[model samples]
Target: MRGKATVLLVSFALFVGGVLALQLERGGVRTTLLVLVFAALGAVAVRQTIRKRKK
Candidate 1:
């Protein structure tokens, strides 16, 4: 389960990096929203991973 979570986190990071690379020119509201959404997802993943570790 931990390994799966790690893979998920890495995949999310890569996806966000790809999005950022594509939006490198004209960043606007959509890019900002995407970043925020991804950040929230990352936070959730981190929280869950920590919770599992404490178990």
Candidate 2:
């Protein structure tokens, strides 16, 4: 429980920081980061699916 809570807190903090940074920069940085994040998430999801199928 403690570990889960710590992870949640850290994730929330990072999300808030990202939002703040996006607001500060209305240029390509925001778009680039958003694409990178989505690509990373998609890769993780695909990897998990492949592993589950292997099992």
Work out the TM-score per prediction: 0.52, 0.58
User: Per-residue lDDT of 1-55 in model 1, one digit per residue for the tens?
Assistant: 8867786887677677657656666567657766776776787678768978999
lDDT leader: 1
Off by over 4 Å in 1: 1-27
Which residue runs of candidate 2 sit more than 4 Å off their true CA positions? 1-24
Model 1 global lDDT (CA atoms, 0 to 1): 0.72
Q: Pull out the clashing pairs in model 2.
A: none
lDDT (10s digit) by residue, model 2, range 1-55: 7855765565566566566657766678888776665665566557657867998
Clash number for candidate 2: 0
The deviation in Å at residue 5 for candidate 1 is: 18
The models' CA-based lDDT, in order, is: 0.72, 0.65
> What lDDT does candidate 1 reach at residue 49?
86
Question: lDDT at 55 for candidate 1?
Answer: 91
Best by TM-score: 2
